[model samples]
Target: MSKNKKLDIDLLVDGLTCIDNYSNDGFVNIPTDKSALHPARYFKELFMSELIKDGVSDEDIVAELDLSDQNFEEFLNEKAMVTSLLAQRLCVVTDMPAAFWLRAQSRFDDFHTRVE
Candidate 1:
């Protein structure tokens, strides 16, 4: 990943923890205006990217995730919420800590501000 992209992920993760206290609910209850720092979309994106990198086709990913194309797109767009199960799937597939997404979000936000 590019440096900026990595920073964005870090910011996203940190923001998730900071805003929601890293609750186990899998939903970050941030205000709509604060959505940029939310981890849902970030997690989904990372999950999808990893799956793709692992040679999983988009169709297969959608099927495995039990999501329709439109729904998947909506989730990617941050217009739909993801369940805790989906988060767990991401963590499992990426071999990343379950809390990694939240921390990445936070670090991304912090890095962006520092650079700007």
Candidate 2:
């Protein structure tokens, strides 16, 4: 693989893998610095990938997310933490199941709260 292609895969893998960072498949076993991967981060990557694949623009996402520039920046930079409204909007736009997004958000909240 080309260097740039390998780097892209590494970034994708970083988003998908849990903090544990090992997969039985071995191909995805690269480690990250996180101790517990946040679901919001995972959701952001998943949603963004789909959106990019479909050629959705960043401006569109910020509007769909009902976020001002600062807020949107904070949300993405702050682990993609999602609310119910964001979940619905994301689902509607991406044709992804709302339940799946909500579940992921819930799981993330639950784990973080537990740790706290």
Candidate 3:
């Protein structure tokens, strides 16, 4: 079974007026929040550094992760959440822990939910 982890948002963006303030390389450094990383940007940075920059093709990731073409594309666009199974599969493919992905997804969700 997956771990029943406790989730919390300990630090918030200190003075973020716009999303433009955050760069895409992940981990927005908030003045008040200190150096806490934003989960969505963190994932994007991880994917780029670990996969895209390493010449891991999108199709290769789809096949290796056992994702359908559509699902893979959607994942790229952040149109879908990473299912628990997909998180585990990602751990195999990317060496990132499934728990880490789950936590990132939770944080990402919270951020977007607040945005909406």
Candidate 4:
């Protein structure tokens, strides 16, 4: 394998290892109490924790996801909505399905709309 390809595989393995270490169950369990929680923040904590555990940089992940730094920061801060395009882009780095992201966003929106 080429050097970059090998590095990418190694990084992926490291990320998976990090996930295995942190997760009690195989799946990500969304909290039952959705009060005062945005899916972006919730999911970002999960995904970013794994990446950070592997020593991956936010700048690198943002570039890989083709997101502007401001936009990514805003998304994390819940100032920006998770659109279909962003959800799809997120799958590339997060190893999660685009549908999972959209579903989380939908649930979050539903909860907040009801609360309001």
Highest lDDT model number = 4
Quantify all predictions' global Cα lDDT against the true fold: 0.52, 0.54, 0.56, 0.60
The digit string of per-residue lDDT tens for model 1 on 30-101 reads: 322243444555655555666677777878866766777998777667665445565565455455544555
Cα lDDT of model 3 overall? 0.56
Q: What is candidate 3's TM-score against the reference?
A: 0.58
Q: Candidate 2 residues 1-116, lDDT tens each?
A: 00111111244433544434423321222243423345346446755666666777778877776778887777677645667787776566555445545655565566567769
How close is every model to the real structure, measured as TM-score? 0.45, 0.56, 0.58, 0.68
* Candidate 4 lDDT by residue in tens digits, 11-70: 222123222222232234333343435557654666677677788888877887788999
Clashing pairs in 3: none
The total of clashing pairs for model 4 equals 0
For model 2, what is the error of residue 50's alpha carbon versus the real structure, in angstroms, after optimal superposition? 4.1
Which pairs of residues collide in candidate 2? none
> Which candidate, 3 or 4, has the higher lDDT?
4
- Return the candidate ranking by TM-score, descending: 4, 3, 2, 1
Candidate 2's TM-score reads 0.56
- RMSD list, candidates in order: 9.6, 8.0, 9.2, 9.1
**Superposed Cα deviation of residue 41, candidate 3 (Å):** 5.2
- The runs of at least 3 residues in candidate 4 whose Cα sits more than 4 Å from the true structure, single-residue gaps closed, are 1-36
